[model samples]
Target: MTTFDKVVELLVDAKDCEKDSIKLESTWADLSLDSLDTVELVMNLEDEFGIQLEMNESLKTVGDVVRAIDEGLEQK
Candidate 1:
């Protein structure tokens, strides 16, 4: 699976939500993800992608997380 697909799967499993509900435009708040969840998601992403993400406040959307991981992968 692509990085985007993997990220979506992670989020879906983490939030206990349907895969169809996840979209690029979907925000953490929209997905009912709290601060703790966000941290856990970040950790999961780091482990899955084997990259350390510099936490940023601007990462509020699914697309942001995908882009961050994609960029991190490129750097690797």
Candidate 2:
């Protein structure tokens, strides 16, 4: 699957959300994800993609997470 698809899957699993509901512009708040949820998601993404992802205020949307993962994978 693509990076965006993988990120969407992770979020869907974590938040029990519908797959179609997740979009690139969807924010953490839109998914009802709190700090812990965001941290866990990052850790999961790191493990899944074999990259180090730092959770920060800059990561405001699912697209940001996908971009971070894509960049990390490119560096690999």
Candidate 3:
């Protein structure tokens, strides 16, 4: 699967959201991801992608998460 797909899966799995319900441009708020869910999502994403996201690296939106995954994949 593509990095985007994997990222989406992480979000979907964490939030119990349907795959079709999430889009790349969908914001965290729009996705109804609570603070705890966001933290879990980030940690799961880091493990899935083998990249560590710093605590200060805020992922305020889905786009931000997608971009981070893209960059992380590039680094790998």
Which has the greatest lDDT? Answer: 1
The lowest-lDDT stretch of 10 consecutive residues in candidate 3 is 53-62
Model 2 lDDT tens row, 23-49: 999998888888898898999999999
In candidate 1 the C-alpha lDDT for residue 48 amounts to 93
Candidate 3: residue pairs that collide: none
Give Cα distance to truth, residue 47, candidate 1, Å.
0.3
Off by over 4 Å in 1: none
lDDT for 74 in candidate 3 is 87
Cα-based RMSD of the predictions, in order?
Answer: 0.9, 0.9, 1.7
Q: Write the per-residue lDDT of candidate 1 for residues 1-76, one digit (tens) a residue.
A: 9888998889777779679988888998989898899998999999999998977797999899999999999999
Candidate 1: residue pairs that collide: none
lDDT of 1 at 46: 99
TM-score of 3: 0.81
TM-score of each: 0.94, 0.93, 0.81
Rank the candidate models, highest lDDT first.
1, 2, 3
Q: Assess the local accuracy of residue 2 in candidate 2 as a C-alpha lDDT between 0 and 100.
A: 93
Off by over 4 Å in 2: none
